[model samples]
Target: MATYPQEITLKVFVNKTKNCVDFVESDLDFVDVLLSFLTLRASLKCECGGDINTSVSYDLNRDDVNYEEFRGVFIKGAKFVVTDALCISLVEDLISTLNKCVNGDRNHMEVRLVKIKREQVLRILKRSLISDTPLTDVLLQNGEGITPKFSDSLAGKKVEKKVIDKEKKVCKLNMVLTRNKVLYAVASQDFVDLIFSFLTFPLGSLKKHLGSRFRMGCLNNLYGSAERLRSSGYMTAGCAERLLNPKLAPYFNCKNQVIGVEEEKEDLYYTCNGFCKLTALYFSCKSHGYSPYHESNQVTLVDPKSQLGGTISSHGSYCQKLMYMVTDELVVTPLSLESVVSFHNEIADPIKTAELSVTEAEILDVLAVALTSNTALTDAFLGTTVGVFTSVDVKGE
Candidate 1:
């Protein structure tokens, strides 16, 4: 077996509080204790058969920690850098010490160690070695280490390689989308577009418009063109919309409702709508394993009345009026009584329509997670018969 050098670099962020004062205060002394522990734990043998190289540095200015603070730790200034085999050892020792302190079961009198960097070890070695001798030569001569070697047969060999074309991999990812996934895709997008597209209509107008195959075809064509532009990384949905439907671009603003006017408020509505529409179109195209512009594929439907409760004329004008009157209350309401009655009679009359679709989905998700933890179930299912049982009994007399 060939061995390779494993160089690990880590940043330790220690916040000193009333609870953590012991670890931060008397920093150098605490660090020495930590270095001693790490030197043993890491099994870092020094070239000169002496103690492992390590260093300590501190910063006292306490400020709020944010993403910028993290960036500043490396960019603006680093408190310290230590490079040596013992660096990882020191980190492990400090973490163990802190874990014990936080847990409260361990004795507070136990010597607490502070973490140091691996770079510090290398710096110490570089300075200690003779100026004329190379660092690698010094370490090797002192019995520290040498480069590992692998057999030529193992190191270099010709094998079949599989290349995942992004175009194809993206297509595979799309195949995971089902109708429910499509709905999620839509919701994840710009809410403003959804409101404008579905809410402003004469209640059911949006549904009626969207439910039609012809309107769907138009959307598919438009989305297909947009997808091509997007795949080429040339234009975004808003950009494409402006390029293709320049006339409609003026009406695209949901908030201001005025052309050639810019507002201080972000155009969240339109931005959201564009994102939703683009995402839905992208996933729909991907699911079918085809480019959005594929001539044979159809546009995915967005059923506003079914998905989002709006006034549907078939549910009756009286019912529609009731919906508007009780819109706030109906927001939390279950699908309407009329719709429920219509569903049982008109949709699934003879068929036993149990609401197990959601349950089935949940079961599938659980199974996926379980399979990751327990491989036996997967192995058993591969070659054996596993019967699926139903809760409901069919005792036909």
Candidate 2:
């Protein structure tokens, strides 16, 4: 429950020898902001900082936080110095340039304070993704430029229309193809619900589902190390589990999360210290009995959506019974004929279309593509190198 200021200050340690940022020192609030990257739903064709460690604990009562103590995970008064080794390359060039000109103390290390405002945090969150560096690639000296260039071999490729007649029908993606690339795809509610659920996924859950091969900077190493530590009995109870396979916060899960990320359930109950009346109305506490009138002892926990004495609506996250248009870049909007026509106009005369029925496996593939590539639809369907779902029943139109 830390209240973040409009601007948060970070103390960065620059190593002159390595020409990179050794780590960053900041309060818990800064870490909170950085952790928001895992919840991004859309893919932004931009670069960002780096993946951060998400295992730190926070105090619920802000007053109990010892600002004076220099803790192992987070330092207090002098700013929590976190050795965020991941994605240091993104800032190595800036550090290298500064190392040459800036004169510093004897330790071959320079300390600099960088102030970031809420505006910057919002901007970063708007464009942030889970696997890639959170810092923009433009900051690095040899950054892999944004929007990976499509290979020439993909040009003039065609995807023909296909239909699958099965006893159990699932959601389908009507993909518009121009040559080798997917111009866009028309997704139904079920598929769109799955995509929207990505925004609610925790970093740990994503890493767990994607597996260790899921490379996004140094996150794989960090997650792997945590797993090893946990099995070795080196980590605190529930620390590694929370960091490695975190469940979505309450009420974050949608109806069709084929990625298998689970949601956290709240089942805490509270009653009065002294029990007298209202014991018959509710379950009696084993120790203190039940006292609904005792306001001081009773703790009420209710779902925010169902506080008014009704169950949560069964409706999924997105609008119901609507078709959505999803671009290769993961831009999702309402499907319309005008937009479809405009997309068709962009493609040359030799345009082809494909209809694909996506099950859980294909949905998982889409999840993988969304995390790693900008051209999610194209890569999921047409990329020869990547594993494409070929066994799906396809009827020639």
Candidate 3:
């Protein structure tokens, strides 16, 4: 009656003698065929078979399902149950092979097995019936679910807790004082300005903004307080060289020098003992037994070395020479003028130099008119002097 005469067939038997029959099929359905084969051939023999009893052995030939060769056929949803069961065993073997790969025993045979198993699993999932379902869902329902290994989970949690505890510990100071010792060497105005600005700000504010240890380190290195007033153009090499000397207090007047107009004059002088060492010399002719208010008399100079090398006629030539030596020996080389000029020129606009030109005669005429009138020139050069003064002393010989 059927056109295709049931070409595929399967037979099931109860015993190894091939005498007893359990099931038989002519038009072999894929799942039925697999069940019949597994039960009859792949299954082991039993003396008293009720439902293929406990005493069973694996039939290698019949049990060996080449998943790669039949992956497409199994994935069509026609033999879903049998295909899934076969796939579970295949995946387990593949996972074992993968473990071997991780342990540095990556054999070609194991690699091929894993590849075949992966292809079969993918193929089965891609079939029309299973395509709509998630791979995770299928694995969870049929294969091993997403349960984590206890040892691995515990190790991970310990590592995470350790990391969190480390993060919770209080922060430690990690900065070094690089600029402290070097500040005296840097005498530029801009450099001094930067340092002074830092010092002038409140320590609490600085600590709050820049950190406590950093501010303390900077202050310790700076040495002097921020309240000290600096000299004009103090960033020059000369000023920087002087900063190395210690402070010195000058001597005052003796009893004889305290009378009349001499009382109004105060003797204040500075001495250089070397780097960052300065002393002020005070003299009083009235108290120290010296002559008062006399130009030619020797008043006994107390701090002759404090003069920083200027002529002292009252103290004679010998004292002058001694003072000069001390100052010269303590002198340090300042930053050169040429370097500052070069830096200034580098920052200035080249185009401004190219802009305007004026003749000397025109400048002189403009200045002459500016001096005589309260006109445009007066507004331009109101507080400024423009020319040099030449004095001619007439001497009759």
Candidate 4:
């Protein structure tokens, strides 16, 4: 019985014309050796500066590769220059030659193992290497890196390893962070918003140039968790606790005492793409294979007790708001409140009318200190001084 020849299409792009040429796969595939086709001396004129042809074959043991000679990378399935016409002829001839040779003979054909160009190799002595260069730049005199023939297998692996992995977690740095390099700022609305904006560019930057490369978290644990993340190529910035001024404590208690556990984490994912700073931490912690929080601080914040005493109460409770603008802005019209609650129950449960004032200078002083001081906003920023869970959990994932 006789069998019909099987056909498979192989696509190749002509550099000069930016057009594709398809050939039968078996006709074009390198069966025994590539030199068989190089013997044809097909000169392909590419848009690149020099000629592209696969005539230069380097032997690993005998050949000393001057960096100039080894133009492209040595990855599998890497392409070299062959003229459009030459490539066409090789395919035709190869098919014809295969028609005569025993089918199993090609499999048994042996050649010295020259090199695996694209691999992770370690040198016993010394070698300098640049990665992911295109064949056009290598074989062709001035071959551009953008030749369609370049197969970016290494590039794909790089992204999978470095970029994609980073996006999946909050990074704990391999390097140590010092106090001087540590910046602890209260989670002002601007900073909270910055965290939100950072999330918008989880895998990439929203605007080119310098993209956001940090995570967001409540200012609750800046000294511990957030700092670790920031030092290790990650930023987990968020709101600080309360602005602990004796005069402002009562008003702050009224403004920020509504924060609860669920709302604390909801901010991270409210507008984010299903990821939060904790989500990143969750991944990073999981990867470490040990619970970093297992031996960590107790996860709770008692109610914020005012130094002035009895005048303020609401510790252990989450802040009602991340930050309240206690500083005043001048208003021409007298504002009327539908309802106002005073700290003193004896004065009345609700005050029908309310009056408030803060000078521009006072406003600037309070906000500047709150936004700048690392310690002022801790109570309000993070209700739990530490964290709730001992470590990251998949939660059904």
Best by lDDT: 2
Ordered by TM-score, highest first, the candidates read 2, 1, 4, 3
Clashes of each: 13, 7, 38, 32
The regions of model 3 sitting more than 4 angstroms off are 1-299, 302-310, 313-338, 350-397
For model 3, state the Cα shift of residue 121 in Å. Answer: 88
Please report the candidate that would top TM-score against the real structure.
Answer: 2
The lDDT of model 1 is 0.25
Q: List the residue pairs that clash in candidate 2.
A: 47-136, 48-134, 48-135, 48-136, 49-134, 49-135, 157-179
Q: Which ten residues in a row have the lowest lDDT in candidate 2?
A: 72-81
Question: In terms of TM-score, which candidate is stronger, 1 or 3?
Answer: 1
Off-target runs (Cα >4 Å) in candidate 2 are: 1-18, 22-84, 87-170, 228-234, 267-317, 384-397
The CA lDDT of each predicted structure is 0.25, 0.53, 0.23, 0.22
Residue 300 alpha-carbon offset, candidate 2, angstroms: 11
After superposition, candidate 4 runs with Cα above 4 Å error:
1-179, 211-320, 324-397
Candidate 3 lDDT, tens digit per residue, 95-130? 554456335532221211011122223232222111
Residue by residue across 153-239, what tens digits does model 2's lDDT show? Answer: 222332222233442334888776655677778888788878776656666577788663243544443455456544654444445
lDDT of 2 at 238: 45
Stretches of candidate 1 off by over 4 Å are 1-217, 223-238, 241-348, 356-397
- The sequence of per-residue lDDT tens digits that candidate 4 reaches over residues 1-397 is 9943322122322233322221223111221122121111111111111211231223233133342233322111222222222221223335555444324444443222112221111110001011122222322222223422212222112111113322222111111011111112222332233222221111111111111111111111112322232344222122111110001122122222111111122111111222222332343333323444432222323335333333333332222224322211100111112111112222312212111121222222222223223232221222222233223321211
> What is candidate 1's lDDT per residue for 162-254, written digit by digit as tens?
232331110000011111111011111122222222222211122122222112122222234333434554342344322222222112223
